[model samples]
Target: MNRSKPKAPAPDEPLPVEIVDAHTHLDACGAKDAADVTAMLDRAAAVGVGRVVTVANDLTAARWAAEAATWDERVFAAVAVHPTRTAVFSEQDRAVVAELAGRDRVVAVGETGLDFYWDYSPPAAQEEAFRWHIDLAKRVGKPLMIHDRDAHEDIWRVLEAEGPPETVVFHCFSGDLEFARRCVDRGYVLSLAGTVTFRNARALREAAVHIPTYQLLVETDAPFLTPHPFRGRPGEPYCAAYTLRDLAQLRGADVAELGAAVAANAQRVFRLPAVTARELRGREG
Candidate 1:
C-alpha cells in the first residue's frame, strides 16, 4: 500500500466510509493511462473517496474527461473554459463545451471565474467567458463551479448579475471571512481544498469555521494543494481525509460526521448517485 505503487483495486472493494472529492483535475494528476487511473482510484478508495468531480480547463480536456467518465464509474466530468484560457475559447470551443454539457457524465460547468492572480487573459475576456459559462450552466440545468482568485469583487458583481446558479459553488475558495459571509448570504456553497489544511491558510480555516456546514464542501483539487502532513508530494483524491479532518477540527465536529456531511453535499451539488456505506465497501474490496 505504498503511495507510489500502481495497482488494481478488487472489482468489488469496500471502504469504511465513502468520500466525495468535490473538485479535482484528473487530467493533471498524471493519470495518463488506465493503470494510472486505477492506482489513483485505488489509493482514493483505500482512503474512502468513492467519487470525484474532475474539472477540465479547455475543450480538449473536456473531451478527455468525457471519454474517461464512461470508463470509470467513480469519475465524473466538469467542462468549462478556465479563466486563464478565456482568450482561447473560440466559437468551436463553445460548441464543444455546449455539446459536452449534454453528456450524462458531464455534471457541472466550471473552474470558470476571474483570476487576477494569473491574469493570463484580459479582464474583460475572462468576464465574458465567465458569463458564458454561467449561461451554459443555467441552460444545462447544472451547477456552476467558480474559481475566484484576487478578483472577489468582480466575481460578486457578475454573480449579482447572473443571480444564483442552479447550484453555485466556489471551488478552492480562498476568499476572506467577509467575502465568505457574502457568499453565505447569497446561499453559495464554499468548497475548501488541501489549502485549508495548511498552517498558513488561516483564511481558509476561518471560512471553514464560520461557513454554515450545509454550505461547506471539501475537495482535493488533486495534482495540487496536497494539504499538510502530505504536503510536498503529488496530491491525490484520497487526501480528502486530511481536508475532512481539518474542517472537522475547525468546526469542532467529529471526523466521521463531517465526512458523511461533505460526501452528501458533493452528491447534492453534482447530482451524483448517493452510495451507501455498503456500496462504498464493495467498491473498495
Candidate 2:
C-alpha cells in the first residue's frame, strides 16, 4: 500500500497566550541532533507552543528523548517502553528506562500502557511492563503518561490495582465522554491531541467540553494525528496552536483563556519550569 507523504500544515498565527505541548515525539518527527531538535522547538515556540515534552515509545527513542530535551530549555522528556514494544521488555530494558526516567529533564515515565489495537506485544507482556513503569513513576516521583488504545477498562483496572502515581496523564487521550469523566473523576489529566479537531471525533469533543481547566492539557502527538482541515497532514508541535483554537471553540471558551489553563496544567503535571515560557515569548517578539 504505497501512499504519498502527508503534506505539512501551513503555520497558523501564534496564540495570544503561551501553551505547552504536553506530549510529542521530536525523534519520530525526524530530529536527530541538537540542531534538528532546536529547529523543531523553534517552530513550535514561534507559534506560542513554548515548551514540549518529547515522549519515548521504546529504548532507542528513550535515549534520544532524554538527550533531545537538553538541546533546548523548552524541551522536556518522557521515557518508557511502549506497550506495543513490550514483548521483549526485560530487567535489562527496565534498568535502562529507569536510568533515563531519572534524568532531570525526563518529566514522566510513559507512553506506557496496553494497546490491544496492535498485536505487537501480548497482553501479558504489556501488563507486566505497564506495572513496572507504574512503579518506576512512583519511585521516581514523576508523573505516569499512558497510551491507552481500545483497552480503556483494563487501563483503569491496572492503574487502580497498582495505586497510580501522584499524577497520570493520558497522552493523546482517545476516550469518549464517559471514560473522560472517569479519568477526570480519578484526578487524571487528559492530554488531548489533534484528534479532537476531527469532524468524526464527536464523543472526544463531548469529553473535551466537560473537562475542567485544571485537569485539561493539549498536545500535538506529532508527526501524526494532525488536526482537521489538515487531518491527513503530518503534525508538529506548532500544530498545538490549531488544536487549541479548535478545542476552545468546541468548549465555548476564549482561546487565550483556554490556552493559559492548558499551559498551566502541563507545567503542573510534568513539573516543567514556568519561567522559560515567558522568556521564550520575549525572544519570539
For candidate 2, the TM-score is 0.96
RMSD of each: 4.5, 1.7
lDDT of 1 by residue, 205-265 (tens): 7777898888888998987888776766677787777778767787898877877788888
Q: Ten-residue segment with the worst summed lDDT in candidate 2?
A: 274-283
Task: Give the winner by lDDT.
Answer: 2
TM-score of each: 0.91, 0.96
Against the true structure, whose TM-score is highest? 2
214-269 in candidate 2: lDDT tens per residue? Answer: 99999989988999889878888999999999999999999999998888888788
Report clash pairs, candidate 2.
none
Computed on alpha carbons, the lDDT of every model, listed in order, comes to: 0.83, 0.91
